[model samples]
Target chain A: MGRFVIRRLLQAIPVLLGTTFLIFAIVYALPGDPIQALAGERRVDPILAATLREQFHLNDPLIVRYGYYLRDIVSGNFGTTFRGLPVSTIFEGKFAVTLKLATTALLFEAVIGIGLGLWAALRRGRWEDKAILAFTLLLVSIPTLVSGFVLQLVLGVQLKTSLGIAFFPVAGVQDGIRSYLLPGFVLATVSIAYLTRLTRTSLMETLRADYVRTAVAKGMPRSRVLGRHALRNSLIPLVTYLGADLGALMGGAVITETIFNLPGIGQQLFTSVYLRENPVVVGIVTVLVLIYIVANLVVDLLYAVLDPRIRYE
Target chain B: MKNPSIDTHPPADEVAQEPLLVVDNLHVEFATRQGVVRAVNGVSYTVNAGESLAVLGESGSGKSVTAQAIMGILDMPPARIPKGEVRFRGTDVLQLSEQARGQIRGQRIAMIFQDALSALNPVFTVGWQIGEMFRVHRGMSRRDANNKAVELMDRVRIPAARQRVNDYPHQFSGGMRQRIMIAMAIALDPEVLIADEPTTALDVTVQAQIMDLLAELQRESNMGLILITHDLGVVADVADKIAVMYAGRIVEHALVHDIYKNPAHPYSKGLLDSIPRVDMKGQELYAIKGLPPNLLNMPPGCAFHPRCPYGRPNCVTDVPPLYEISGTRGSACHYYREVLDGTVQ
Candidate 1:
């Protein structure tokens, strides 16, 4: 097992390197100079612009700039943003907010989704199963942005007056738990639908397995048959989806955050790109890529733990 | 190969006075997408306490289905017992409510499945799974259950029961897993134990050991043993009576010695002839001509008529009822005498 984990960790190195390098190249290759964007609309002397370019290493060759970036990255420096803020400082504050929101959303999705899935599977061919299936399908098909706007209008605008002052704060993450409730729920609904369907299908398949039948014949109660035997075995496929979904959710939260006006890494990335702040954009992309790699690694390790048959190698 | 000393004890007839389990006119069918497939058609048999009854048939011959029906574990919507009475201690099992049936299932009647590797849950320790029977049914405490589990493991001859009790099913060898299954089945001292092809997945040597274990356990407990398998050789030493099932019907039912020495039904004759005996050298061992009949579209008369070597014109038009040929021995064949006397050959 130790050997297998070591092999997997070794394999992850090249993947992480490739991802980081690709994002670095793409951010640099995009049109519009960071130096020009930083200089802004106000008039500045050409001599001063040249001095600024040299200071920021913008006049250096692409490879030389890349080497300097790599050196700074190795020394735990992500360079300074075009706004002259340290990349780490910008990311630390924004990342904490995004992490809190995303983590809460994911936890909510997993619990509600998996619980709904088990309920649907157990009550198969009944009205409750049909209702859950139809509702989840509806939730899945509706666009996340549209859903967020709709929820914001209903729960934030009209419901506040009609339904005894709406419980959740419509925008931002400042109003404690209530402020996060709307956007978090909106972000989670789509993922919850997807996960619930996946879990339901996987659980249904597991319940029909010969081993489940054997367990039942052993005089195991219906609850134990479903919980201990079927659910544990069914988690293999669900875990796989969870890892990939976590990566996608971190990357995909851009639109939802924009719609709800939540101050998260996704929103910060959007602002950085639009403002042509090269360092912040590049740093956020690199972090997102790193998150993907780490999430996959965690998933691979978890797979080995959940299923005895799986070897990391 | 006569055992005169063993024979001196008593023949099966003398001991057939009290039946431990009696299954009468058992009809089982499955509602599939195509249609209702008659899996078990009017099958009947009896097993006395301390007797091992072997229901012999190839795959899909309704052997396992019969066993499952008897154990009350048949998945209902798909598998329905259209007609039957599985009476244990004069109580019709099928007539009981779901809760009542569950009460009797593991406590009174237990089943050991074919695939031992899959029979046990892969995630849980074998001991925990085994102990669950006691914990769930008997309401034993956790410590008591664990101790009982270790005792069971030791009884099955699993080495180092103390250490291995914590090991999952995947950690054990195939033979050892099968032993664990046997231990679970015998844990509660069930009155009737149904072993459905218990050794089918084991090696030849392991198969012998499992059979020996089953026999030893049965003798000690005096439980009615229902050994379901297609292997005629397996029943040679263990089964007191043998019932040959074909197309879901018991075509031949007799004492094990009688069936082996004087097989009456043409299907039974074919089955006995097919086994490659050490005494019968290179003169081509017989193979039954065709596959067992499809239950969905079974033949109008005897289901085995298409495959029976001694099939007659009447055999194609009429189903033969099980007729008593001698004391406590019966055959569903019109020409039983001819087959037994070698005239059919």
Candidate 2:
């Protein structure tokens, strides 16, 4: 297992390099000069402009600049923003908020998704099953952007005002965990729908499996058969989906963050892109790529735990 | 050696007149889109302690469904027991509440399936799956259940039971996996062990070994063994009696030797003749003509008439009842005497 983990981590190097390169190249290729955009509508002195360009390695070719960026990253320097703030320092608080939001969304997805799915699967073809299916379809149909704003207005503002209760904060994390609940659910809507369907299908198939019948034949009670045998087997695919979705939730929180006015990496990523803060953009993407790799590795390792047939070399 | 003093229930041996397990007039039907499939229709059989009954049939003949009904494992929405009584030692298990039936399930009557890889839970170790019988039913501690699992594994003749206890079902060979299934079934020392085509998925040599092991285990425990299979060859040595089914009904039933010698039912005669013999070296291998009847659209009369060599015009319009041939035999054929006397072409 140790050797397998080492092999997986080593494999992550190329993936990290590839993703970082792609983001860096895309940022470099964007139409507009960062230094001129920094000066914005001002006629700066040519000498000062030249100095700024040279200082930032903006005069160099894309490949050479990427090489320098890679060297800095290898030496533990994620570079500084045009505003001269270290990108890592800028990331500190924002990463935490994004992490919390993503965690919240994931918890919502796991609990509600698996719970509804198990319920639906057990009571398949009934009205409860049909209602859950229709609810999931509704969730899947609506985009996160619309759901985020509409929910913010209804639950965050309208409900709070009507009830004359400070139930939900309109925007930001001022209310700590409670502030994230609405936005977290909005962010989780589509995923929860997908996960519910996956869980339902998986559990249904698992329940019909020969092993479940064998469990029943073993005189195991209905609960044990479903809980121990069926549920455990079905959880394999759900775990994989959830693990991959964590990285996705973090990266895809841009719209959610903006709608809720949350001070997260997603908002930082948005502003950084508009301002042409190439260093900050690359740094954030690099971290996300690392997370994606690590999450996948953890998922693969978890497979061995969940299913003994999947032993790694 | 590790027999933890299991609570001594009333010995099934005391009830000599009442067979260990009796499946009487059990009718199972599946409600599908096309129509209700009559899977098991009026199938009645008795299994005595220490005796082996081989239920012989082609696929879809309802032998497995009958077993599932007796086990109370059939899914209700698709499958329904319209009328039946599965009596275990005198008590009708089918009439009992689900909880009562659950107690009787692995504790009193256990079952092994054909495909061992699919039957054994893939996520759990063989020991855990086997030990589950004791853990859930007997309320044994994990350690005690595990030790009992190892003991059962050893009893089933799995090599290096201690070493392989933690291995998954996929790690074992076909025969070895079936042994694990058998081990789990017998872990509770059930009074009746129903093996539903247990050797169907095994290699020829391995099949013999599994049958021998099952026979040995049954003898030691004095358990009633219901060996359900399609192979006539697999039954000869182990089975004391046979029940031949065709289209969800028992067409013939007799002492294993008696039926093999002179099959009264034409369908039974056809099955016995289909068995390849070295003495008839150059002769064409005989096969029962046509397919088994579809459960949803069964023929009006005898379901086997389409495939029977002795099928007559009357056979197409009339369903023959199981005629008592003698003291220990019954044949569901109108022309049983002609078939038994070798007077029919």
Candidate 3:
């Protein structure tokens, strides 16, 4: 098992490297002068700008600059912003916020999504099943960005602009629950839709499996048969989806964070790209890729626990 | 082979004892988009403790469905048993509450299905599955159930059972997995066991091994075993009585020896003739000429007349009721006497 995890980690090296190259390419190609952008409105002399370029190694080849960034990344030094603030220090606070949002959203999605799927599967072909399925399809059909805005307009809008009361706080991280609720709910709905569809199909197929029939024939109670025998088997695919989705969600649903004005890493990454903070952009991308790989490894281990036939070796 | 000496019962006393399971005029129908499928029609049979009743039929002949009905495992909505009574020791099971039925379904009467590889849960260890039988019905502690699971595996003749108990369904051979299913079914010493084509998915050698294992288990427990199969060869040696099903009803019910010597139904005759015999050598093996009747749109009267060699004109107009051939046997044919007397070929 240890060897399996190590091998998986080794294989992820190239994926991380490729992502770094892509992030580096984007930051390297931005059109503005780094010194001029840093100076903002100041009328800096062309000679001073030239001298600053040399000091920053701007005259060197892209490869040389990328090599320096890579060395810093390997050594756990995430370079700095144009203002010289360390990338790691800036990321630390946002990381916790993003992590909390993703975790809470994941919990909400899994509970609601998997619960609906099991209910629909059990009451298959009934009106309630049809309604849940239609609702899931509707949720899946609407893009998260559109839904996010619509939610902000209704629940987040203080109706006094037209009617009178705000049901949920519209934007920004505030104290306690108000901080993540609206944005988290929007993020969770999309994942909940996907999870619902995946879980429903998986569970329906599993319920028809011969083992489920055997379980029933064994005279196991309906609860145990569905819970222990049916749902446990169905979770293999659902868990795999969850693992992949976690890293992606944690990296950020850009539209949700941007619309809600959350200072998450994804929103930061989006802002830093336009600002030409190359190191911060590359730093966030590298971290996300590593997170994705780790999540997949954890999912693989979970598979072994859920199914005895699967061996890590 | 390792079963203790079976307690012998005198024939008169065996006859007087109440049957463990009695399916009387049972009707099972499946409602589909196309139409209502008459899966089991007026199917009636009885199994007594220590006896083996083999229900024989081809695919689509409702043998397995009947077994499922008896086990109380048939899915509703599609399946509806509108008429008939499944009497357990004189108590009608249809009238029993769900919990009461469950009390008998797996505790007093358990089932072993075909396709054992699929029947055993792949996600769970074979021991866990067997242990589940104990855990759910008897309410045994996990450790005690686990220990009992190992003991049951050892009883089923699984090699290295202590080590193999942790192995999942996919890890075992088909025969071994069937053994695990049998072990789970018989864990609580059920008085009746219905094995639905238990050996169908296994190779010939494995089939024999499973049969031997089942026979040993049955002998030791004296359980009423309902062996449902299409293969005549598998059951002829083990079954005491046999019921040959045509379409959805029992066409011939007789002692195994009597049925083998003088089959009272043409479908039974045809089935027996189709078995390839080594003694027959190079001659083309006989096969029943046509398919069984479609359930959704069955033939006008008798369901088997299309392929029955001795089918008379009346067979197309009227369904023949089961005719008493002797005190212990009956045949659902207009001219069972003629067939038994070897007058109809």
Ranking by lDDT: 2, 3, 1
Q: Rank the candidates by DockQ, best first.
A: 2, 3, 1
Off by over 4 Å in 1: A1-14, A37-67, A297-305, A308-313, B1-18, B278-285
Residue A144 C-alpha lDDT in model 2: 93
True contacts kept of each: 0.52, 0.96, 0.87
List-wise, what DockQ does each model earn?
Answer: 0.58, 0.85, 0.75
Candidate 3 scores a chain A TM-score of: 0.87
Model 3: clashing residue pairs? A159-A164, A160-A164
Give the TM-scores of the predictions, in the order they appear: 0.91, 0.95, 0.90
Docking quality tier of model 1? medium
Instruction: Pick the winner on DockQ between candidates 1 and 2.
Output: 2
Best model per lDDT: 2
List the global CA lDDT of all models.
0.85, 0.91, 0.85
C-alpha RMSD over true interface residues, each candidate: 1.4, 0.6, 1.0
Candidate ranking (TM-score, best to worst): 2, 1, 3
RMSD in order of candidates: 5.8, 3.8, 5.1
List candidate 3 segments past 4 Å from native.
A22-68, A81-85, A159-167, B1-17
Better of 2 and 3 by lDDT: 2
| Candidate 2 lDDT tens digits, A1-313 | 6776687779888988888899899988999878877888887789988998898999899899999999999998999988789999989889889989999999999999999999999989999999999999999999998898899999888897888777788898889999899889999999999999999999999998999999999989888998899999999999999999999999999999999989999999999898989899999988888888889999988976898787732
Worst 10 residues of 3 chain A by lDDT: A158-167
